[model samples]
Target: MESVRTTTTRPAAWLMLGIVLVALNLRPSMAAVGPLLSAIRSDIPLSFSLASLLTMLPVTAMGLAMFFGLGISRRLGERRTVLLSLLVIGLASLSRLFLDSAPPLIASAVLAGIGIALIQALMPALIKSHFPDHVALCMGLYVTSIMGGAALAASLAPLVLLHGGSWREGLALWSALALFAAMAWQMQGAGSSPVAAAKAGRESFFSNARAWWLALFFGLGTASYTCVLAWLAPYCMEQGFSEQHAGLVLGFLTAMEVVAGLAVPAIANRSRDRRGVLGGLLVLIIAGFCGLILSPHHLGLLWPCLLGLGIGGLFPMSLIVSLDHLDDPQRAGGLTAFVQGIGYLIAGLSPLLAGFIRDRSGSFEGAWWSLTAVMALMLLMVLRFDPKHYARHIR
Candidate 1:
């Protein structure tokens, strides 16, 4: 392949916009649904377990789809895959507008899951390739957008339902955002050179331990994110709050995550090694859990803020670590897919297990217990990770 220069500032700006737009769409479909799951379940006359499954289905599909994303990204070109994914997500999200039965609703979930998985798994690699110098900033920006999207969707979906008439209209509103993202991506794609496109196909990234580590860390971190977004709203309502208030609280938590998610990792990256940063985040996570259990109603704002902060740090740190650990951009992409694939798999189960525990125990305490234990395990993994040397030896 002929050589090609790195992307220029004009193209980079467009890529950045595309990244933010794509990231924004990733979480809304998943997070928005949780805030309304109970209402949807009641309206459809389905079991609580079924409601939980609807939430779980997308996450599971996300993980499952990530398992093959590197190859898919290679085949389609990362830009094309992302653009296509956005289109699929938009269509799937649009499908909810016509849903008259449980099966179609579930199909929407699955379609959104697949689209999200493709984007999530490939985003790290895309960032590394397009913004190698500004990865830390880019990571922060992308994650903040993710939390912002979740917060907006969480609060707005129910409001839309109340104001716009039905749950279908509420859910379908996000599809417009997804469509906007798809358009942005297509615009960015027009600037790519033939050499860049060819090189993308030649680059391979799915066969190393570094890839596995990235995938694992991403998986673990996202598992926490998924758990929080999926169950927090329901937990709030279950604790005697009204649905509107519950949705607002969840929105607030997600908004707090946007701030932390943007700031924490950027701060952590200032250090030579990030183990200390990781350790600190784990401590905060532990504190967040304690807050959740002991002073939930009283502390309210503080509790979710702490959890959001912890999650924000964890998610972006994992992404930053993946980039830091990989020498090649393609390897970064491969590792991203691996980590997200596994991370999403783990994430997919959090809501389901939480729901099952809640159903059986008649309380949300079990969910907290599960989160605490996962946080502990994640702490160990982050502590053991030696990002500086790990990737070179991973082969």
Candidate 2:
């Protein structure tokens, strides 16, 4: 990897485009699964719990991969790491084209998850490093692109199936997007050398109670998201919606997420204390879950809209709150990575848990109720995040 030349005027624009493209590849592989889960199971014969692993396994891989993300970057270099990850993602998506049984399908999920994690684990610091003055803008774009990719996959996968493609074809279609992202990334990453990996473990916050709190907060917030991403389409189908409409619901939900991801942070930015905003987001989530449990078929769109805006806003806000704990970008990025790493591990099980509840209760209502309670718990937790204690907790 070579370094970018500051004197070159064209590099910045190209790099930003590359970052956006790379971010777009992160979620489609996993996101496409829920909308097509029933179809896949109809052919492949998986129980609800087993099918949940398609999402859970990859999420678990993402969590585990973060612990070793630095080692991969150190050995392969950041630029190559991103390219390699994109290639891995593309091949994993491509492999779904021939998947006959559940084993290989789950395996690809893990493989793609690992690939997504490698890129994600590197990107934050990369953005902070190269786009110093524009870190916020770049990060915003990167986060939005991730949700945007999920929206595309969710909305389009069913359309693909409707137009004579099998569920396998729908899953495999993301390979094309991955290919484009890889090509764009390679062009921008040319001559970009490997930078030194940040020393995140040096100032170890593993023992800090506050770090654990942040991790738990982020984890619960993420659990809500993973559960929905893995089950929303199927749940919609249960409520009597067709596959296309179910897909559209998830797609629209994620689109709302993209909007909130950008909008919520901008609004939150106006205040140093984020608790009020956090509480509002939690209320939206609780309301969304309640709507799903009580009135899914009647006011269906509103529930997803509420959930998406809440969870989407919560995702970035959790990281922002964590990042606020440290002054240094490297250290802050490290903490955010740590929170997400643990958070993913917690999150990976949520879809599986929801699946189990659905199996036992004969409906997804129990799971939604549980998530509502979690949101309520979060509302209580939000009160403790006083801005004045930021330094004391870390110190």
Candidate 3:
């Protein structure tokens, strides 16, 4: 198999900047909706079950779309795929401007999800191929930009409502970011040939034990994240925080995530194995989930900080570990997509499950405890993620 060739004079700086810009658009289309859920529900007259579906459908789309990412990239090339993703995201986001009800809104969210799935599934491979010597650092920046977008949207969505703007406007505003990213990406010039395409025929991703483990690990971690993103604001609001304040709290959590997302990968890069760092972060998430369950209102600030720092670090580390499992960029891309595809499908259930738990229990305690259990599972799973085990799977 041929390796991905790179030009010695490739514009690394501009490429990194483009990656950051594209990454920044990945999460806002979904993250922004959570904080504004109440307002949207009030206007659209949606049930809790239906509202939960608003979050679930997109994530499900993301998960399902992952399976097709490789095929799409093969047909369109990576650069064109990304550009198409940005345009899809922009159009989907703008669709919300005219949408006033549930079906259309959900459709827009699903479209945005498809775009997000394609870009995210391909990015790890792009980083591995382009920044071979600095995969961890590049993944760190990419993940940080993703978290930063989530934070910005989560923080600002409620503010848009607080200023008397409609939910449609609040949701539509993020399209501008997508548009800007599209423009920046276009300026970066032509796409590279699909680097990971050749390896697709060598190994069946489903047959690899390590792939299954990584997918499960990724799914469990994402479930925790999805629950938090979908419910934390409403949970806080139930505890007497105003909508704006709850959004800010969720925003604060993602902001801490951005900080941890950038720092953890950089620190973990110094080590050959990341189990120790992964272990410590899982502990923090456990503590945070426990706090949120037991006394959410008492130490409100601390719980999210812990959650943010822990999960923030875990997100990139999970992807980085998967990328490190194989030397071939194409193989790594296939593995990463499989991980995200299965993981996100699992994660798509979280918001709905949390909503079910919330509706049944009349509180989010069950939801929080469920996440705590997931964190424990994540800790146990990471123990098996020794890099040596994955080294054997590399073709």
Could you say which candidate leads in lDDT? 3
Better of 1 and 3 by lDDT: 3
In model 2, how large is the Cα lDDT of residue 313? 88
- Candidate 2 regions with alpha-carbon error over 4 angstroms: 1-11, 190-198, 201-203
TM-score of each: 0.91, 0.95, 0.96
Model 2: pairs clashing at backbone N, Cα or C within 3 Å: 1-193, 2-192, 2-193, 3-193
lDDT of 1 at 32: 78
* Whole-model lDDT per candidate: 0.77, 0.85, 0.86
The predictions' CA RMSDs to the true structure, in order, are 2.7, 2.0, 2.0
Model 2 per-residue lDDT tens digits across residues 1-395: 44544415557778878888888899999999999988999899899999999999999899888777756775677678888999999999999999999999999999999999888776776666576655545666778888889999999999999999999999998999988988887776633334445365344667889988998999899999999999999999988889999999999999999998888877887776999999999999999999888888777789999999998889878877887787665667667777878889999999999999988889988888998999999999999899999999985
Comparison by TM-score, 1 against 2, better one: 2
- The list of candidate 1 runs beyond 4 A from truth reads 1-5, 190-214
lDDT of 1 by residue, 122-230 (tens): 6776677777777888888998898888999999988876674677877888989988888877876623334333443354455665566666766666766777787
lDDT of 3 by residue, 8-115 (tens): 655788889999999999889888887898888888987666778877888999999988887787777777889999999999989998986789998998999999
Where does model 3 exceed 4 Å of error?
1-7, 194-198, 201-203
